[model samples]
Target: MRADAQRNRDHLLAVAGTIVVEEGVDVSMRDIARRAGVGLATLLRHFPTREALLEALLRTSFEELTARASALEASDAAREALVSWVRECVAWTTEYRGATELMAAAIDEPGSALHASCVTLRAAGARLLVRAQAAGEARGDLDGDDLFALIAMLAWAGDQPALAPRAEHLFDVVASAVLTGAGGR
Candidate 1:
């Protein structure tokens, strides 16, 4: 791709990502082009189709999230690190709601890139969970799948702006339950 073409692609991805998160995935491609200061042909040339664009956006986000998760120090205060990572994950989910939904939809589609990314994330999260459990800071019985499910639930709840204020409380409760063996009602 030419330098200008690459710049246009990057701009379109950034602008369209925000628009999709604020609006819905059904937002017009022309609008995306307009916001990106690119022609509709340029946008289409970069993304080809709406699903293609969504998949690319989601893959990029998931890759970034996985990298962040991998960079977290497992040897630190395990409980605190886990809590902080969960909070970060929640923030990402809330900030990219539409893209996340598209990712979920993509996971259900066979041979989708999102499904592959999900698998990678699961493996990395499992490693972190195992390390925390080994350090006796987290529940021994809690597997990666369980942690993933818990985070997904929290992310869904945190997606609502009205529920934003309660996220910390919810995170605390979950952390206590998973780490300290406190019974969460």
Candidate 2:
């Protein structure tokens, strides 16, 4: 891509990321182009599809989450690290409107551009989960997949305006139920 085209692409991605966080993934492409001061055709030339745009917008965050898991392990105890990572996962899922739903779909759909990112996130969560289990901080029966689902549920609660006030309560409940001897730890 030429320098000018690359600049346009970067601008579009940045604007789209903001809009998705404020509005939703379902926001129209035309509106994004309008906000970015570009034509819809130009946007399509860069992203081609809404999924493509979403994948590009969130890839960095997903990668960071994976990296954060490694960093957290070195700094925090097993239980704290797992819980903190769960909190971070919820934050990521709720950072954008409809992100919880998007992540759920992305995790299972092999064809989705965000699928690999989702896989990496699952691995990160699993890494923490293993540490917690080894330390007897989490239930031996629980696995990374379950932890991922827990974060997803918490994020779902966070996204519901009516449920936002109870989001913390929901997180506590899920975390308690998942961790052994935690009692909402």
Output the number of the lDDT-best candidate.
Answer: 2
Candidate 2 shows a clash count of 0
Give the distance in Å from residue 164's predicted Cα in candidate 1 to where it truly belongs.
2.5
Give the C-alpha miss distance for residue 63 in model 2, angstroms. Answer: 0.9
Q: Rate residue 110 of model 1 by lDDT.
A: 68
Residue 28 lDDT in model 1?
89
Candidate 1: which pairs clash?
A: none
Model 1 per-residue lDDT tens digits across residues 1-185: 88987887788889988898888677889999898887899889898888778777767877877887777853466655676677777777767665446555554566765677766665666777777787777888888778777777777777767887898788778878888544421
Encode model 2's per-residue lDDT on 46-136: one tens digit a residue: 9999999999999988989999999988875889899898999898788887988888888889999999999998998999999998888
TM-score of each: 0.82, 0.95
List, in order, the clash count of every candidate structure. Answer: 0, 0
